[model samples]
Target: MYWTNYHGHSNYCDGTHLLEEYIKCAISQNVKAYGFSSHAPLPFLTNWAMPYEHLVLYFKEISELKQKYAGKIQIYTGLEQDYVADFNLIHKEWIDLPQLDYIVGSVHFVDRFEDGRYWEIDNTTEVFKEGLQGIFNGDVSQAIQRYYALTREMVQEQKPPIVGHLDKIKIHNRHEHFFDESASWYQEAIEQTLQTIAQSNAIVEINTRGVYKKKSKETYPSHWIIKRMYELDIPVTINSDAHHPEEVTREFITTAQVLKDIGYKTLRVLWNDQWQDFSFDEKGMDLK
Candidate 1:
């Protein structure tokens, strides 16, 4: 059995270690294929994303690393692209020129503040509450709806190969303080978004970061959503969304078990220069 992780980060963005450090760790973990998906450069100033000035250097370094690590492990270059209404993957000039192996389209910003700052949905609990009051006037349902709406729009319009953290907006709703996942409105939003993703042919990543980070009780697009996904026959991939070297495959065993219990017999992976499904167990995938 061998493992693979496509969502990762390094010092180029808000991540801790250098890019090479993550590669070395993946090799130690026996990862067959590893992808570097640093937070993509945004038009506006943000602390987490790769700076606009470093975009050229980021690509150059990854290209060099790919060659240096060839045959030992399969390396892929990608970006966790954010989708705002005005500035998205399609509109980004530099993103179009680069030869990205894959794109993990995501929606981290819901709407802009009155002063024109993009409201970050997953940054911190305080910031989330601020946006809840400022943007939706404490109407948690509307704010959550808008977040899923942005995701649906991205899938329907831009339609990247992968969709990152499908239900990440629920990170702050840990204790059911805002709304219940079983609520009819919440399920409707998720179902509608899943329908859009199914039509777009985008793979949904079952991210484990929330679980390991203690931000949420389950993976993004939680167990219930996974059940719904199984019903819809949506393609699913497992990603750690590691920002630190040691976090490369954290919580993967438990997550795989969860998937198994959900009746998922196969997981999608980018292998042999293409995305394919392979049978898997808690140990790892049967790539052979």
Candidate 2:
């Protein structure tokens, strides 16, 4: 059995290693298809996102790696774009360019700080609290509401091919001090967003980075939310959201078993220039 991963990073972004290191590690992990989805250039100046100027080189480098790794693995190029509508990043014409194989849209920020900086929700505990109180006047419900609203808006209008880390705003809510996931309002928001995703062409990715990093006990979207996605018949793909070479397929096998337990029988994979669903188990997919 072999794995297929479409979410990964390299030195071009915040990832620790170069592109080739991830490819070599993926081959060792028996990955048949791997995609490099480094964080795309953002409007704000941040150390994590790739620089806008590097996009040309990012595409150029991935193109070369594909040929060099031919017969060893299938490589695809993608970007983890931040869908910040206020900055018009999501509507930028450059996103739909031919150089990209796919886009994994994510909502990392809700509103902006008084100083015009966007409030990133999944950052450190102090930053998260600052946004919660400063932007929303300490109204946790309102903060969470806006986060999901941005998600719904992105999927409805942008319709990114893959939605990254669906419930990542909860990254700082680890202790449930802000709000309860079982609360009616929280469930309603998730239900509405998942319903929208079910209607759109986007695929929801079950990200394992949160779990492996100990920032979250479960994968993004949580186990119960995943079960709800199954009931809604939402298409899903498992991704480690790897930022390091050895993490290409981190937590993948256990995450697969968790998916299986939630009643998922197939996973969507981009292979041979097409997106298709393949039967999968704890080990990997039955591509043969």
Which one is best on TM-score? 2
Q: lDDT of candidate 1 vs native?
A: 0.88
Q: Rate the local accuracy (lDDT) of all candidates.
A: 0.88, 0.89
At residue 116, candidate 2 shows an lDDT of: 92
Could you tell me which 10 consecutive residues in candidate 2 have the lowest summed lDDT?
Answer: 85-94
**Tens-place lDDT digits, model 1, residues 1-288:** 888999999999999998999999998987889998888888788899998788778888988988999888888988988888777544365346556888888899999889999899988889998999998999999999999999998887667788999999888788547788899999999999888887878999999999999999999879999998988889898899999999999998999999999999999999987999999998888774
Maximum-lDDT candidate: 2
TM-score of each: 0.96, 0.97
The sequence of per-residue lDDT tens digits that candidate 2 reaches over residues 1-288 is 999899998989999998999999999999999999998887668879999889999999999999999988999999998888576654466568899999888898888989999888888889988998899999998989889999999898677899999999888777557789999999999999998999998899999999999989999979999999999999999999999988888899999999999899999999887999999998898764
